[model samples]
Target chain A: MKRIFKIYTPFINAGMQETATYRVNWVFYILGSVLGCFVSYFIWHAVFLSGSGETMNGFSLPQMIVYIFLIFLTSTMIGSDAAWAVGEEVRDGSIAMRLIKPVSYNATFLFQELGNKLLTEMFLVVPLIAGLEIVRTVIVGRVEFSVVNLLIYLCSCVLAYLINFFFNICFGFLAFVIKYLWGANMMKNCIVGFLSGAIIPLSFLPETLGRIFMLLPFASLNYTPVMIYMGVYQGTELLYYIGLQVFWALFFFGLSKLLWVVSVRRLSVQGG
Target chain B: MKHIRRLFRIHRIFVVQELKRMMEYKGDFIVGVIGFLMVQCSNLLFLWIIFNNIPNLLGWSLNEVVFIYGFSLIPKGIDHLFFDNLWAIGHFTVRKGDFDKYLTRPVNTLVHVLFEKLQIDALGELIMGIALVCVSLPQLQIEWSVFKVLLGIAAVFFATFIFTGIKIITASVAFWKKRSGNIIYMVYMFNDFAKYPVTIYNEVIKNLITYIIPFAFTAYFPALYLLTGENPLYNVGMTVLMSLALMSLGVFVWHRGIRAYESAGS
Candidate 1:
């Protein structure tokens, strides 16, 4: 166990070094975020214009803009289609070398991915976010964010990453059984987009669907946290959301471990 | 005449081969069709929600909006069906060095790349589009004048040219840099914005869409004619001419870009 930890710590440290560098594929990251944020600004701006109401569902224009901004920002920051990456690696025989290492392949990936994500968020997402905030203030003409709410939002964003990672790993590990995991990843993307309220806000959903959405683990990654930040929920609701996130993180993480073990066994049987 | 026939034969063969390739996974083809329909249904639901809130958007009625969506979908569907490969052409050609094979071909490399794949599932979107048009025509309460019907056909064809033109231009960007995927995404973003009435957007963005990007011609101008039961502006002739001209310009730009291509791998 100690040997495994030692091997992975250095592997993750190397990954962290690569992650800390702001050179490779960073342009695509910025371009995607900029395009997403810019296009969304135009879309919601038009939607909001169709009414004379002061707000849509208790969110003022600025608040709504913030919601959209954070939704895109956090989705880009927190979202990891790990299954897609892992499935590709396994299918291409890269997993062979990974499995031979002293540490568990999944453990190494978990730490490396977290490190890469942290690097991306700090170097790219954070600066872009700061610029977006400035732009939003200029365009919407006001800015209001509570420090406590911001902190909570940030923590939930991190938890969202864990949930996403676990789901990805579970689906990714299926590559051991299925030769092609593109379809599975596609389905995962579709489900997560809808369930997590990343497509459209849960607040925008019908009351019954919104209630159902709240019950789903996917909501903890996005909708619940954003709403809480927007002051849509108070103490008990906030606590419930955070607690639900904890439950989901643990549940999915455990499931990923089980899936990993089964997948490894299947791979060994196949001489893979 | 003989040359034209030979070209047509090659096009047909290309399409047939693409169809055969797609047939390898018949289950996927079916699921893909269903998935596309679900996506279209979601877009239609957004329209329904909008109409439920208000009877019409801007001055256009529900049927007019539906007509816009319908016509837009036709070009979009055909774009995906025939030129679906355009989205990936940049990446495949430049990054992966797939352009070497195209350069070796006797035919126009651009045409070869553009028509390499036909996403058969987009046929579902096209059928839905035609259905929406038929449904919308009756609800719009318009006379079936000969000129109006002809204009509608022209509009749909014009839309195809414009959309294919944009895809070609965006794909041609791969000649310069490998990161042209975002360029394609930017085009799609504008295409999404163009689905609704132009009047819904603010003045500056509206102008940009119309004059600079020419996305307005894809659905907005055509839908306006259908909605008003007359040409919305005296510039119908000008708009049609402009659409064709822009398409030609796109082709010209693609020709220019292709000449500068440095095939990455081979």
Candidate 2:
């Protein structure tokens, strides 16, 4: 583990600096997210108005509002352009040059994506959450967030990040065979956006479907952490959720390692 | 008259060239359509999920809300299909000095820029919009007439121009800033607000959409007008006025931006 960390630390640093170079995009990124926040607010506000002035399923209006912001926060952490980057590199044959480098490709991408996520969390997501929370408080009355829940939420997020990154690398590896992941990438995002509970809370779904989704790895992405943040899980239940994240994290990482080996062999460049 | 005719003739030639290029990537096109269709379906699913819990959104029924949602997509899809090349300007055309190609051409630069490519992925949104409208029209139960049908068609046609006008104005910022993709994105995403009933928004946001960005006229107003027979002058008429105003502003900006443009030193 130390050896792997030693190998990838510089790459992670490089990735962080590379992302920081595009800091002009930071303002617009924040602005775009504000719109998303408003959309959530309006939609949920309307839903609450239309229904009985009480909690739907288990989430109160305030909880749902907070859930939306937490979704934004978690999505920011889990989201990475590394897969899209990999697809582009693979398509353009840049991966061929990287192949000769005496390091692990998947590990390099894994850490680099971590670096990107860290930078975004620092410069964009964290600050936006602070701002959104104030707005969230003013609009929907403050819902208590316990310290224990926040800590567990952060821990679950780390595990979720691993699961998300490995899944992306595995998905990106498809380009080595298919040569373009544009459509596949879109399909992946569209599906993930909903399934990861970014679109709406999974608990809002029918009970059976909700239970089934919790078993799926995608739940570890945004749903678990947000649920934890909302204090929906505690004690043994919280530990179980964390265990699920750990299990999926390991599963996806293994899947990515296997795919990486095959992908390197399958890599082919079209035209000079 | 002759200049307009020449530009139209040239646009046709460019479009034909684009169609031929599109033919080379049949697989990409199909996958893109399917992918976008799925994307739209997911949004539809969100609305469906919400409605499952409740019967209406701001007194707008599921079908009525879906009607606006679907109506919003049509103008968006139209702009996406034809004017997507404009995205390049805001994204990288100015930064990469690709805009020079437009200037060096014999044809008008704006015309050349616009006619350069046709984005096929937008067909999914177009097809989804049409399908949604057709499916929901029966459920909506609006008093229909030949005049209303023709008026709706005109409203939709003008709405497409509103999208193009906004895109053009936003994209022209690249000439001055070298990269205005983010600005364009921030402005363009306001259209999402337009997809829902504007009444759901607070007074501030309602005014913001109607006056500043004018996206309210794109879908919500026209949909409201069509369904409820509200002020024709305010709804459809404002749509026409906004489109014309935006188009003029777009053209004016493009010209001003062209003068200010400085290519990257190669």
> Model 1, which residues run further than 4 Å from truth?
A1-52, A127-143, A173-187, A265-272, B54-56, B232-239
Model 1 TM-score, all chains together: 0.87
Q: Give the C-alpha miss distance for residue B219 in model 1, angstroms.
A: 1.1
> What is the fnat score of candidate 2?
0.64
lDDT of 1: 0.73
Residue A73 miss distance in model 1 (angstroms): 1.2
DockQ of model 1, rounded to 2 decimals: 0.25
Write model 1 residue lDDT over B1-266, tens digit each, in one string.
99878777888999888778777877667766766676667667656754554444556677887888887788778777888887787546577876778889988877777767788778778888888888988767666678877877777777777778777887788887764766766666677667777777778878887887777787878777866766545325545765688678878988888788776754
Which segments of candidate 2 are over 4 A away from where they belong? A1-6, A135-143, A270-272
Please report the candidate that would top DockQ against the real structure: 2
Worst 10 residues of 1 chain A by lDDT: A20-29
In the order shown, the candidates' DockQ scores are: 0.25, 0.74
